[model samples]
Target: MAKIPKVPKTVLPKPPRQAVPPPPPYVPLRARPVRPQRTNLPNQQSPPHPSAQETPIAPPGTTRSDRLKQVWDERPRVSDIKRLTPEQLSAPTHQNRMNKWRQWTLFICGMSAFGMGLYGMQIYVSLTTAPDENAVPDDLSDRFDKEADGYDEKVSMAETMLFLNSRRKALMQKVRGHVLEVAVGTGRNTPYYPTKQCATVTLLDSSAPMLEVAKRKWKETHMEYFSRVFFKHQSAVDPITPPYGAQDGYDTVVQTMGLCSTNEPVKLLHSLEAATKEEDGQILLLEHGKSHYEWLNSFLDRTAPNHALTHGCWWNKDIGKIVEESGLEVVDMKRYNFGTTWWVELKPRKGMRKQLEDAAKEEVEVAVQKSWSWWSFWR
Candidate 1:
């Protein structure tokens, strides 16, 4: 084994030490020079820096949360309220227009309130006061006679309001073949009847004066079709014979505003059915009655007694119920004015009833035959 030679040890010289400077002389905080703080004049404010505008600088000692509260508290108080002068008030600017609108609104509100008050008072009086024995006539026909002379004039306003002439036109346009118009008051529907479509038009009413007015109206408007028009003075509930032209039966029987005045509306409807042909005859009716809504129905019921005395109509009658009880089949039915006004087309159900009975009889016969066959097999 060879012995390893030892490496010679090398020594490096050390660098000289540098001098250390003495610490700064101590000075008391109170002895230090004070910097002058910049302040804005009372009337003049300094322009905000661009950075400060985005992020506001808080006071030296204030915390972030306290800075927000302090900023809110130091905010300047200013009012934007303004008063208008007479010139500005009367000017035709937006504000002036707004004022006018407000005035009109107030006027309308006041007028509506006044009207409502009057209506409420009327309802109260009608409900509270005992009706006089002589207030209404026992024979309502007499009331019609008395009103016949001015009947057209009296109802013109309401007719216009309700657009009844348009309704009459619509109904009369549907009239075909021989026509019978019951409760013809002042012939309001006469002008609307199609001369060519109707083979004959018979006007029937209980009130003689009303009949006279109807005749006059027919003579005035439909004199050209005088041969086709006839006037009959009788109650609608009375048994009516078919006119000379319509020997089988009236093809169309029309009654407008009639059921309201009648004591026996169901009887009237039945009588109308009897007068009409059983196969193809139609009964057309336009009437005002109890509304679908209970509130309106209540108003009608509350006002009915007094209204009947003056108008000779029980306005609260359930026209639908009356028609249902009459046993006539409704062909078409429509309502307007919140279901208070009804336009109905009805036909006799005799043919339908016979058909149903025949069908039932055939079914019974088939069942009986089946049972007899089963018994025979068992035997």
Candidate 2:
């Protein structure tokens, strides 16, 4: 038994010693987690973590300024800049971002207030002193009389804007033969009439005082070329069929920036057609209408009330559509000033009379269904 035990002991080598894992990673006691700094605005972001290389541990700095200088110096050099991502390039720094947010918030609040004010004003105008059945309101006659004396001078202030020199020269030179000018304010079109070819002239306006100013303008110009010059104080909105119409009607109907403020622009167009002779008669217009540009149109809309009060002009009228609706054939039309200014040449179509009559009847029926008490638009 002793021999067997010795043999086993001699054969077996010591079992390989086991290797122990390195002691668990040394972890120092963690300080209380720093609560993030609160910001007044929403979406505030956390500060970026600086890499160990970027973070300069000031060696017992002598002063706070010196410590800050050392920290800034640790910032990445220019050679390392190419490693930056697009987010870093596109994003504003925290302070700049906060400032931009504040400015946008203020701007949005201001625009909201302005929009609300415009809505309130539109509602107020709709409720008070709506227009009547008569296309030309009675008060408008009195208002024109008041504006008559200084009308030319006041309108002249816009000369540079209107290109009055070139437009008037082009528009007025077209009128020839017995001419009828409807709603011819202050005879602005008189000087443009063909000096040699105009046989007779008839000036019509709703305001007697305005007619007087036109008469004065004609006299001042000394237009001896005309066989006769007649001044009529009549609303062009009325039917131009009989005694009220020009004695011999007209060979040309001239409208210069007239129908923008008219109570019934379509009606006035019908009357102009009625007053024009069936043969060789046409309408020439130099007018301002809605601008094609949205920005300019929005500006005009915002200042609608001021323009309505100052000049009897509608800044956003659709003159082109009105001409089409009137059933007049447009021989030629030129748009200038971003389509805000219209130079139109019109002639009577064969079936215009029936179209206008039907339109009048439909207008009556429309009024019966839903009343229209003021000018066409909000202004």
Candidate 3:
């Protein structure tokens, strides 16, 4: 190892002290000199000149004592700041207040929309289920059509009830010949039936309570007509074969607000057709059905099940197609009461009577053929 060289002593430079200059000599300002006033000589008074009576004037910069008195001209004393600069009160501040208002408005609107949405959801959920349908009896025929007094009076007081009853009366008057009224609740239409046009009337329903009411009403209003009116307690789809009697069959069948609650409307119409004279019989209807409007139909579909559960009625049905497919020709059809219901009158097609006869003959022939084949096989 080489011997280390001797280290030199390092000295740090010291900062110099700056001298602070002494403050300038203090001197008091001299007072302004006052001018001497001239005095009048004793006993030698100069004759009073016009200029002598004049008030003494103040020097250039001096103001008169009375004039110097703060000009307190009752300046409109403003309790607040009076002279604000334009920049201090600009439109930007006003805009900030408006923005705050807009925010508050938006918050209120959002809350209102949310509440409405929840209410609508609740209504929709209640209307589209089958629990209500299961509660009704399979047959509601006799009780609904029972003749009763005061049934109309009891129902007509409500606006909705009165409207339904009035329309029912109007529709029943159109029936003729051997007439049948289906689901004739409380026999309200019994008083309105045209006895002249209809030689006999058949009232059909399934509810026993309703039929009892109808019976009382029919006996009270038109007992003579009741003699011609027959009451039947049966399901709409029950068979009406030979034992039911062809002479007793109806030529004109009417239904109002009935199809909505039927278990199988298409089958019900077919059964009605089978119970009548195919060539001469007709079906008249005034009923609310599934709407053609997409939105309305959707709403009805969703809510109908709920209505059935709560009101013992269905709100959705396709009455037109059920009638048409029952081998009837639609003669007249119209939407009534703002498209809420349809009124239709239909008759069997000209060819339908012949077709039925042919079908019956074919059925017999097929039975004969099958019997012959069985006999041959045994032989």
Candidate 4:
């Protein structure tokens, strides 16, 4: 047992020493405490910020003066805008004076030419057209018969020049329900009638030829409404009988330029009044008469004789006065073209229609009595 213990003690080797990490490299302690270096984790670096001293980079090839000018132009200003007055805009100048002078000269020349042409036209018509001493109220039928063929063509230019078609349209647009158009020459107002509004339209004219022309026009323009229209070859001065369906009275009585042709305009208006519904019936008249101006009236008066001889129209008559004398209530009245053209809307007075009817009835009774007496005497 002694030999075994000595042998184990001699065989054991010395143990190896363990390694120690070096102390962190010497970092000198700062006099003032300094911020410790930030320890960044993997892939977590921050971007650098711009400094206040940075300047804007100019565009290539642009001058400093050019850049300054661009900045100046883009800057906003409140006082740059201005508005000019009419006086400043229309300041007198040589060119402006010349233009005004030329305009005035042309206007005067044009007016003079118009006057001369009007005088010449009157002369030409008076000389060319045959005048009949009998072409008064009773013989107007004959005169119109002769004039019917070329009448529309003869008057179209004057009507257009005066814009008379528009005036007729304005007047006829007011017509509604059962309508009676007296002195419907060639049916110039035919196309303007609202066919859907009028239940019946009676066209009355003195001349058979004129009625025929009106019939043809109505057929051509409003053939679908044929059943609604009727033509009467009779004078307006005579009592107007309502068409077959409208036996009571016409809703509207229209006469354009007729007062100028009739010998007794007031009588014509009275007849119209008699033919309309007493309560709500309207009488529409578009006529040419003495102008408001005395100078124009004098001109019309001077030319009236020849004009009447040629056209059988006494255009110098005072239509307003005639309407007033007819005793109809004036609803609306307007004048155009220096008061020579008139548009009148009138309503029948309450008892005026009855008075006219009684007078007419008495006259008819007297005529029948006279005829009976004459027949008895012959027997």
What tens-digit string does per-residue lDDT give for candidate 3 at 137-243? 65433233342444455335432422666676778777778777777777767777778797777777777667677777788887777777777776666654322
Superposition error at 25 for model 2 (Å) = 99
Report the number of clashing residue pairs per model.
Answer: 0, 1, 30, 0
For model 4, what is the alpha-carbon lDDT of residue 118? 88
lDDT of each: 0.79, 0.71, 0.64, 0.79
Clashing pairs in 4: none
Candidate 2 Cα misplacement greater than 4 A, ranges: 1-139, 223-227, 241-248, 351-379
lDDT of candidate 2 over 40-125, digit per residue (tens): 67887655322111322346636988876765674545555477676765544533544555687799888767766865676456
* Top of the candidates by TM-score: 4
Per-model TM values vs. the true structure: 0.60, 0.55, 0.52, 0.65
Candidate 1: stretches off by over 4 Å: 1-138, 351-379
- Judged by whole-model lDDT over C-alpha atoms, candidate 4 comes out at 0.79
Q: Which stretches of candidate 4 lie over 4 Å from their true place?
A: 1-139, 372-379
> Native-vs-model 2 lDDT?
0.71
Better of 2 and 4 by TM-score: 4
The digit string of per-residue lDDT tens for model 4 on 249-271 reads 89999999898787777888888
Q: Indicate the worst ten consecutive residues by lDDT in candidate 1.
A: 47-56
Which is better, 2 or 4, measured by lDDT? 4
